[model samples]
Structures are given as C-alpha cells and as structure tokens.
Target: MKELSKRTAGFTDSVIRRMTRISNKYGAVNLSQGFPDFDPPKEILSRLAEVTKEDFHQYSITWGAQNFREALAAKQSHFMGRKIDPDSEIVVTCGSTEAMMAAMMSVTNPGDKVIVFSPFYENYGADTILSGAEPIYVPLIPPEFSFDTDALEAAFRQNPKAIILCNPSNPCGKVFTYDELKIIADLAEKYDTFVITDEVYEHIVYEPFKHVYFAGLPNMWERTISCSSLSKTYSVTGWRLGYVIAPPVIIDTVKKVHDFLTVGAAAPLQEAAVTGLNFGDDYYANLQKKYSEKRKLFLDGLDTLDIPHTVPQGAYYILLDISEFGYDSDLEFCEVLARDVGVGAVPGSSFFKEPENRYVRVHFAKKNETLNEALNRLADMRKKIAVKK
Candidate 1:
C-alpha cells in the first residue's frame, strides 16, 4: 500500500484533546480544552429553536447568508472603527478553526515562511503545516508574555509571508497592548507581510485592559486578516460559527479558498447566530463581568495552592509554572496531573516553539462549582504525589 502523505505524517494528536481523554478516564475535572462548561445565552438558544422551525435549511450563500454577513459586518465595523462592505469582505466559516486554515491557505505557498509566536495557539502550527508553510517561531517571554521587538523584527527580516497574531492570547492570557500591536503593525508594514489574527477572546477581557483589533491599526486593514468566532461570545461553540474580516483583495482570495474548502458554514447555525450579531453592547459588558468573576475564582483557588502562574488579563486561560517539580517534561506532568491529581490541563510545551517543558495551561470557563471541585482536588496534589514521587 502507498504511504500516507508526509505532510501529515509528523502530526501528532492534539495535546489538549488528549488531556480531555485522560480526564475522562480518571473522572478528573477537565480544564484542558478551552470550551465553556456552561450553556450559551438564552437569546441564542431561543433563536436556534426558532431557526429549526423555519425553512432556512438549505445552504444560503457560498460566502454567507446575506443577513448574517450584513449583521456581522455592521457589528464588527462598529467595534473595529472601520467601514466594512459585507458583500465584498466577509466569508462566514464553520469556525475560527476553518477561518484560520482558510486564511493560511489563501496567502501561503509551499515552502513559504510564516512567523508564529511561541506559546501560541496549537492550531497555528497545524495551519502552517497544512498550508505547506514553514513556521519561524519567536518566543514571547513568560510572566508578561511579551516579545522582544528586536527578535520579532528579525523574524520579519527573514521575509515571512505572514504573521499569526493571537491577541488576548490563549494559554497565557496575555492581552496585547496597543504599543505591542503597533510594533507588530510597523514590522508588517515595513516587511510587506500579511497579519492573520485569532481574536476569539475579544470580549473576554478583564479590567484595565482592552482588546485591540490589530487590523484597526493604520495601513493594517489592507494587510490584515481577522479570524474570529461567535463561539465564545455567544457560548455556542458547538454551532461552529466564525468569520474572516479582511480587505476586498485578500477576502476575494480567501473566499475562493473557502469555497473549495467547506463550500460554506451550516446555514441553520448562521441564521440563528444572526440574532447574536445584532445583540446590544450590554451583552458584551455582561460577558466580561461573568468571565472576570470566573477568572478571580479560579485564580484565588490557585493562589491558595501556591501554584505560580501568569495572571490572565483577557482570555480565560492561565499558564502555571511547574518547573520546581524538577521535571522537564510538561506532557508527563500533565498526564500525571490528570490521572492522579484529578484535574486536567494542556501541556504548555505543546504551544511553544522551543523545547521548554515547565508549564501547563488550564481553562477557567467552567462553572464555579466545577472549578471549586477541581481546586479541592488540587489541594491534595502535594500529599498525593509525595508518596509516589
């Protein structure tokens, strides 16, 4: 028999998903994946129920349902401070996962280089591989999760075709400040490269920090591809609704790629999510408040356990430093954590470009009771591990 494609041969199972499986095997509180354990908004759920009764069952448009795109365009444009032509600039995707892939495939050619920040979303690496692009990783030094501008500029100097930016980043929860975004924008402009962004956590920011849309920067809208999902905002991850906001030229190319990829997102889901798109500002304010409360609850528990971690400013994830455990393998640590500690986390090494293995990421999107239970189990971690270690 012929061998499998070498392009996919090196790909391993997702560490986050693996931890979820381990969590299930041990009955652990699963915080490995980033999905919320709670239900979506009542409005969205009701809209979905209404959609099921309607005749919007067939595929709408290959790009998106007309109303859905218009609603999304208006909402995004209002926040992004830019005029967006729904007809020319939007392609609704199955999820941000598909949007990222579509964006990568649109701009990248085989053997082209793309700059990826270390401790990035794992999907960025897969996007590069699937697009046949080589990734050049620059470390975002921890604690602050800030990158050295010199290092970033140097990476761009290598003539990368694009850079994947995840603002309000996952795993580490770093919200890229305007200053940071400016440095990257300048580098992109100077290097003549595209910027593909994953801004899924745009509304999940904590106090004193604001989520900056990278494309909102001067001269950036033309070169930037904004990929985001309604999953987190509306708590409808299962709906798999996302979209790409880009300039007409890039959106034109991306729409063609998206057409051949999935044809279009699910029509019913898009039709239902249009309700969320037209939601008021109060919806977002309440979302921020709820997530901020969850963040506090989880972090307060972690503090009691004396677990050293980076305090998240935006995203609903925190990266705990476990270097003092005297182990250099985060994967092993995470496996033991799930199997023995009754909690699950993604190995931070999986998100890094370097060979570091001293951190693990946990999601705080679970219910208060769920997080409390996880914390209670974690309190016994040292006692439980002492006997075995």
Candidate 2:
C-alpha cells in the first residue's frame, strides 16, 4: 500500500512493444519493434542446437563466460582498432539494456546530470531516471538528425557527470561522423566527463558512413564505457547477450553492477553466440550487403508510393512523415495505421524529448516478402485512413 517507486511511476508500457501488440491484434505486419523476421546465421543456430546437449547449462562467470569474452574481445578489437583484454576490460550483460543501465549506475550518482540527445532510444531516458541521474537533452535536429556544436558544448558546460552516445542512432539512424565524434571527444575531455555509448548498431552501417568507436579516440579510452550487444548483429534479440567495454577501473564497477543486476547473461546463449563472435569478416561484409539491399527495397517502395520518409544511414529503421494526416497525436495515428493500413509503427514522439508528433518510426528488418506486404498495405494508407482537415 506504500507508494510505488517514484522514479518509474510516470512510465507507460514501451510504445514499441505496445505497437507490436496492436499489430498482432489487427493482424498487421509488425514493423514497430526492430527485430529481424529472418533466421540467425546457420553456423550460430547449428552451434546453439549442439550446445543444449553440452555442459553449458549452469551459470558461467558473473562478469561473463571465459570463451565468450575472448571471442568478443577478438572480434571487437579487430574492428575497434585496439587490443581489448578479455579479462579486465569487459562485463557481459543481459543485453544492451542492462549494459547501459549498469554503465549509468557505475558512473553516476543521484542528481548527477547526463547529456542525452533528443530523439533517442526510449530506454536512455528510463536508464537515466532509474540510475538517479538527471538527463540534459540536446536536440538532434529532425530530417538530418545533426546536433549543433555550440549546443553540445553548452550542455557540457552544465558540468554533467556523463553523456549517452548512440552511434548509428536508433529511430533516426544517424551515424556520427568522425569529425562530429571528435568534437564530442574534445568536449568530454575538456569537461572531464564520462561517455557511455550504445553501439548496438555498430555493424549495421550503410555506405558512405562508418561507426567510429568512441573509446578508440585519443585520450578517451579511460573515460568511455562502450555498451553494445550481439542481438542486432546476430539477429538474436531474445538471447539477450550484450557487454560493456571500458577501462579496467570502470569495468571493475560495471562487473559488480552486472553481477548484482543479472548475475550473468544466459550461459548457454553466450556460449552459442560465441560462434557468431568468431565469424569471419566475410560474414559482416555479407550482412552489410544484405541490409543495404533491404534498405533500398523498403525506401524505394516508400518512394514509389510517394510516402515521405527519412532514409537511414546505418540502422534498419525509417521515420515516415505523417504531417498531412492531420492527427493531433502520432500514437493515435500509429494505432489506426495498424488497425486500418495493416502495418505497425512506433510514434516518433516516444523517442523524442521534445514535443514531436509528425512522424512514426517503422523498421525494414523483416524478410523481403514481409516488407513487400507491408509496403503493399501502406500503398492503401491514404485511402484507408481519411486525412482529417
């Protein structure tokens, strides 16, 4: 009968998950939650089947399984352009969700300020609140989703404890350029602030854009806590395998936080995903090619229907403009879109700190046939839902 947790009292169910439920209710093609409809790599799947019969049933190390850490360190070091010590520099988490939460808790105290970009993944907001950190939201301007240097520096001047960086950002899919990242690095160094990154979409970048690892920047290795996951890369969101890559000191705290939080990521799943972590470069190259094709197919279909959208530079998400629909709330529009147009979307408002409602976010991570079906249903959108005057 006592008051429930004040930190989470205002929270509603995740709009992304809510829309997926709505999609199921209406028998719509669910594009709201960003999970692939296709299967994971045959190699990993084959290994997973083999592992169930093996001796990975019990819990592994509290921080991570030994072989999983080694494989992840090797894979990440190759791309991140540095040697990552599997023993001291990593804490495998339940997912990037727990990775971010643990990172937030590790670095921040109650009432400490953490800079977060507007139009962020919804979890960033919740993570800050749950960690007892105050969020300083700086807008990532719409359409291009770029932030101004002056505004970011101004946020830095507030003496925040840390900043949350989402490279190949969700919803908007803006891959932060090296120059942009340099500015952030400079500010972080000048302000003596920590940089906690969500690099979940690190491998999913498109052509002409690249994922620059924040910790790889000069003088940033000690101050950066890089949180990422195997979920997106391996198409195994349900497996919940993610980790924090930071300096030994920071990771020491993260390991403690992680141990108390989830004890460890699923032992068998981590063992299975180690197969994916050890995959050759050819696998990543093929993944890039496959996502590129899907992006083109989906965006081109939207263009053919004259549906206005923001093209993603990295991730599989697209933000569709619905300004002409005249709906006061994008949430209502998304529900109607699911019920009538037979496609699901998350209201853009859920991702933005600002009062925004002119767009809804959909993903192209489904199979080609699934995307085509969604596109076909979307072609009848205007006719299906009358535009209010």
Top candidate when judged by TM-score against the true structure: 2
Q: lDDT of model 2 at residue 185?
A: 97
Reference-based TM-score, model 2: 0.99
State, as a TM-score between 0 and 1, how close model 1 is to the true structure. Answer: 0.98
Over 269-378, each residue of candidate 1 has an lDDT whose tens digit, in order, gives: 98888888999899999999999999999999999999888899898998888877766577888888888899999998898878878788998998999999999998
Given candidate 2, what's the lDDT at residue 320? 96
- What does candidate 1 score in Cα RMSD to the true structure? 1.2
- Model 2 Cα displacement at 48 (Å)? 0.9
**Model 1 residue 221 CA deviation in Å:** 0.9
Candidate 2, residue 314: the lDDT equals 89
